[model samples]
Target: MDRTTHTPTTDQSRPLPHVVVVGGGIAGLAAAARLRGVVGGGARARVTVLEASPRFGGKLMSGEVGGVGVDLGAESVLARRPEAITLAQAVGLADALQPPTTAKASIWTRGALRPMPTGHLMGVPGDLDALAASGVVSPEGLARAAEDATLPRTEVGADVAVGEYVAARLGREIVDRLVEPLLGGVYAGHADAISLAAAVPQLLAIAQRERSVIEGVHAALATAAQNPNPAPVFTGIDGGIGRLPGAVADACRAAGAELRTDTPVASLRRTAESWTVTTEGGEELAADAVVLAVPATVAARLLAELAPGAAAELGGIEYAGMALVTLAYHRAELGPLPGSGFLAPPVDGRAIKASTFSSNKWGWLDKAAPESFVLRTSLGRQAEEAVLDLDDAELVARSRADLREAAGITATPYATAVTRWHAGLPQYPVGHPERVARVESALAALPGLALCGAAYHGVGIPACIADGWRAATAVTAGEVSPDLVSGTK
Candidate 1:
């Protein structure tokens, strides 16, 4: 029952390193695959992926409902990032990618679904006049946003909450009205708790470097527009995000990396030279290098005995629960699927935070069919935790009511599907970067040990892939990358 797949081009008579990845999620898989590629087919280290669940991908899951595809976990990837796109091409799955169908999105505020302002990057509006014309925010809020140039520069470290920084620079109206909703949609976190440094370093750097957010935004936009071939605005597979995990898994297997499902890890301990891993079934494994690519909480528990200080700090990071409810209805039932989808402001007092017209978000989907429209609605954030507690029937009813008010849908849907994630999304609280730095610095002292996953840098798919690749590079050479170890350029 020894599950090890490795071939060393280096002198086999000499000692060869064995790597054990404690998590079958994408982070672990990416780390394993990248290490093999860098080390070459035969010289690559023996790699084993230990997963607690029956399958890989961690938070990424997809399934077909009534012959229609649905993504139960992460839905899309940002095209501007090089990690995901590069990984896709390297793994032989680049042909499956597609861009976001439209740049426009709807906002449910002040009454009904209205077109969101043009040139608005998340909550930071590029054109004040365009934002004022969108009717999403009040005139007073718009006026205040235009005055961000006068806001004084802040000396806060690279570990402050997004709410504290944005509200101080822009105004409470902007944060509560737009920034909070956008962050909640992405991280399912509270703005008051999410770290600007950890969750959005780009935004923080802009404010810190330029001393004026408006000028920074304009400069960045101009630079982006000048690129000969800019990346896609957004990306998703033709079928769903599930394709990504499958592709990564296939690549790992092709690279001769051992993969096991339904084999949950029981415990892990670090020794002077290597790690001793125990499985739930009492199996034991010894590896020269170890990668813990999972949630901070899971990694904390696994490394409690090895790195006590780091584990203690990691265990403090909190996560939130979320639910996705997809409703299918005839176009006549919901009326014309106007625009993209709508995001609900925190002040709206609604059960759902956002709803996307899935059928319209991608061209790969069959739009010529006379079938019903598919609307994917998300519920449960700090503003409304009770929504996650709702039963299937209740969730469907609540979604229907919200759609009726927001999208002018009156007729009932032909079908409804629901998926729930319990404490799935990690919340990077204020001072998160400093805490992560402490943990990483301590871990650097341990030989051939690397940590990767959404719990550290970012929650996006691209970020997770980049983290895994970085971790693999660090552990393969028995040294930590200065950029990754320091966590800042």
Candidate 2:
């Protein structure tokens, strides 16, 4: 069926199924889009997305600085994962998708900016020689990392923290210098606590197979190298990844999905006939099915009365806040910086967790503002809320100070912007996968219900889109199925 023109089914005896998506973020929008694709218009079901915020695109936001378009939140989506890419194409972004101009990055460790080492999976170097050449890991650290080959098999029983497991095999240096920074860049959480099973399951699988992680990494890398077809690891729209949410929302609307912003869902009541979502404005919308795509805390509150067990599971999930200090300097003052950006290991005690040289990373951003150079530095991580609490000027000052130390970038930016995300990124501590499973299991009792977000599954664009698809499948299939929400891709 042409979803854009889909009308209600011919059976007048049955009214159209209504799915209320209680969030307008990428996950919610993706869910709406999926529902439309599956049942166009109301042929199968009609979707209504209610967002508490005034705008959509929860974390994937596009903004302007120095008269140039740039991403204020997430910069890119994993193109290798078909969900995000496929959704982008479905929403008419096939031609708009663009890969990064440069993948080269740096790791700021041991008081210097070193080239991000190659032959690695999520910063766990498969080749020690390449790792040593990058100088990211110290000589002593390299020796300890090399010990992984000779070390006895380390048991990764059910699940273990990524840092704890890797450090036990390699040394703490590799975990602190390499893995921590990489994981931090992704989750804004500490590697020592982040779950290997939930965050990097591939690494966990490798740990389980090979007696040594290094050997496992080598085999994985070798297999990847032999593959005839490989996809870009990441992708973004020409304007910025921020354009994705707007485009997705447009597509959902075009498909006859109602997307309402600033419409907060106050409570959800389950009747024998249907699920009734009450808005804070006192408007009650009856939904044949519902997808809880909001934040954990919000979802917990909404599910408190309906599915208390699922709400209890959600209550255990926590979030981390951070700030993005975006700076735009005159091209005359600064030529393209060395690499795309650098990840600052928390061990370095730096104010900024990571930095992205926007102009150098994306061809479109570079071309969009030929006269200006753009870059952004992120600060704060899980339990590091004090840094993000600093005033905007102080945050900018701190970011500049770090840039000066790492990249020798001292020229004051002509334009600057600070974007703060309070309780933004969800932390995936050990046993998070089990927790997600329990949540899903509990939701199985509530018919015509599903939950999805960065909280349960992986926290990325592609993962969120996949979660949305899972929720759509569950609710559309006419059951409360949390089992479908498992797996990232």
- Candidate 1 residue pairs that clash: 9-42, 9-43
lDDT of 1 by residue, 166-195 (tens): 788777877877888898998898888888
Error of 1 at 159 (Å): 3.5
Cα lDDT of model 2 by residue, 127-233, tens digit: 99999899998889999998998898987787999999888989999989899899999999999899998888889899888898988998899998886888888
TM-scores for all candidates: the values are 0.93, 0.95
lDDT of 1: 0.77
- Give the Cα-based TM-score of candidate 2 against the true structure: 0.95
Off by over 4 Å in 1: 8-10, 14-16, 38-43, 331-334, 367-370, 382-386, 478-489
Model 2 lDDT on a 0 to 1 scale? 0.86
> In each prediction, how many residue pairs overlap at the backbone (N, C-alpha, C within less than 3 A)?
2, 0
Question: In model 1, what is the error at residue 389, expressed in angstroms?
Answer: 2.7
Error of 2 at 84 (Å): 0.6
